[model samples]
Target: MNIQHFAAFRAVMMTGTVSGAAEILGRSQPAVSRLLDRLEAELGLALFERRKGLITPTPQAHRLLDEVERAYVSLDSLKNLASRLAKGQGNQVSVAVLPALGLSFMPRVIAKFRQDWPETKVSLNVRMSPTVEEWVAGQQVDFGFAEMPVRRSGFETEIFSNAPYVAAVPSGHELADRSCLMPEDLREGPLISWTPFVAARHLLDQVLVTSGVRIEALCETSLSGAAFEMVKQGLGIAIVDPYTAVLQADERIRLIPFRPAIPFNLALLRPEFRGSPPTVDHMLSFARDLRDDVLARVPT
Candidate 1:
């Protein structure tokens, strides 16, 4: 019997459906079904009896699944070990970072990572918080760089910094004269917001709700850079992450500190307690170095 065939059978039996198995294995439904068919053909055992859109595990299937499951888990552990041995100190890192931070924060970290591990090739994925969380939780990425209060399951997290909120206003706007603005100051004028689902948007809503600021949102955009650009054009005022807005250095738009602090936690994460490949470990170590060096002097 083929090992992979057994593995597929185990996944299908455990998940109770081909679609669920496909999700875990990151394959298409038809592909997973084909694998299951191939497995049954090779083993000469009908592992599951399908009825009424549900998979019924046979007694024999249940008995065989236990051994197959253990074998696959052991193989996974051995694969991790062998991969680490094969690399023996390599400089390739695959990482996922939230789009908000990826724009400004990752460059400094990447530069430091490159300097320390000259051969290290760092690949950065810019995704939303949910996507980053899911990728790390799924063990699809070696590491994830993102704002904390995230929804990642089976992961370890370490906070690096508190990313503060800043008020972005046109250089000559009335509120621009003030060194800082209150949540109320935001509502008085047309307001710009990020996409409603982003962490910043949630934080903004929380701040507004707590402060009793029923600020009207003139527009919502996905990018802070774009929001700040609109503010610079005097179209409206925006509150955005200091990291992304600070990078713009748009003299036309000033970054003013805000009261009733709005902050997000930045963290480094890895899947919970799973042994990392040597390349993964080296990259993680270097990423922390890069994070510390860059975050320390961000001036936020």
Candidate 2:
């Protein structure tokens, strides 16, 4: 009922012994037992049963422990946040991104952000799209970047950028001579592609099928950057977002537009309960400027 009562209850339930709880609470064993007894009397429920100097939690105690731990964890987080603010290091932002964006696009944005706000700290996590969506919905990060149209509630989504998928060919490969590629052009070669579960893969499959083009698949990968690497190694021609193609471009690989353009889209997401930090808005503006410039010259 009171802070002391809750603390005693938690300490005793957690440590499973009156002496251990007493040590944790900086009290004598008798004092700890008295606190527990008072709490039980106040609530008119037995929180623990004791026999032979061992303490065992009652059913109600087990049910209450989870809520108690959660409250303490939140309090601990608040304490840490206060400490950070005291040290003048609270200007921090966290973002969750999918592998495709993390590979190169986000690194560029981070660098630009640091250039402008040198004192601000940025944390980035590269995870699957579902995880990114979940983090955004849960307010775990300032925002998240992921594939478009995340259907989860409790988040607002906006278009980040869009570009067409392009073909990646190894230097001196037969397709390198072509300025643009068609599905039929890739039919004779082994295709390096994303895993089947990827949205891009669904689009690619539809295009190939509708064009009556089929090819042997050399490999399927989760990361577009990995597909680009395979292309550089002459594994096969790969279809990837223009951002990745531009990032991985070199004399060893050529990026060309594929016919019937498959759009690569992304979204900026924010939780409904949290307002975007000014820094986040600024970063969003900076990223859009960079995206416009980069996408304009994406080699096709």
Candidate 3:
């Protein structure tokens, strides 16, 4: 039950010999052997077999090793965390973002944040809105940028932008001449769309029903980039957030505002329990400036 005994056993299991384990532990071979003997006695199990100066783990040792390694992994993570704290690198910010913002907007925010706080460590993860919300609730991240209306109750949510959705089409498509499109305009042809049940898709569905316009969806995708690619391939036209349109706007793709404006809103999610880390406020200041710049340039 002693931690030292477990350490000795883990070292022997990893190194395959008492002498090798001794070298790793900075102890004599005989001392490591004694630790192993004590561990085996306490556990009432034969952990290894020694023969011809070679050591081999017994079946019981292999079974115990699974749990041992799992524990050590947690310990190693704690050690790394402590090392970071000791080095004054604990003023870190971790953010989770949905694909659209992560791809288009976050890089600008991160770059500006780094310019002001070069010593701060920043980590960004691109995930689905639900995953981002879960990370915020779990305190696994300092902040999350995701589609708005996150269902969880304990987080502070702030709408970052509420631009209208835009239509993505192949650059030379017939509709490219128009500055904006109505649902009826898109209803005529095959459309690339989000699958039913997606938050944005659900909202769009209600609008379609209300407008008496049914989209002839040829293909559905979860990622904005994928939908944009499908549109570029002439598969179909797609309605997407302005942020994605801004990132993917190119000679191959044309973005036009969608009429009646399905508001493409994104928000920041931060847990109530953790309170905002000071680094989060600093990061958000940079993010707010970037959001304003992006909003001004993207299609209305």
Which candidate number would show the highest TM-score if scored against the true structure?
2
Colliding pairs, model 1: none
lDDT (10s digit) by residue, model 1, range 17-123: 88898898888988888888897787788878888777788798888876675566447645755786688834456678887668776766677667667765566
Q: Write down the TM-score of every candidate.
A: 0.64, 0.73, 0.72
lDDT of 3 by residue, 174-253 (tens): 88888888888886558888987578898878888899987668799888878888887888789888777876677888
The segments of candidate 1 whose C-alpha lies over 4 angstroms from its true place after superposition are 1-90, 276-300
For candidate 2, write residues 233-285 as lDDT tens digits: 88888998877887667789888889999988888888888887788987877
Q: Which model is ahead, 1 or 3, in terms of TM-score?
A: 3
Write down the lDDT of every candidate, Cα atoms only.
0.74, 0.84, 0.83
Q: lDDT at 265 for candidate 3?
A: 79
Question: What lDDT is obtained when candidate 2 is compared to the true structure?
Answer: 0.84
Worst 10 residues of 1 by lDDT: 291-300
Would you list the rank order by TM-score, best first?
2, 3, 1
How much does candidate 3 score in TM-score?
0.72
RMSD of 3: 8.0
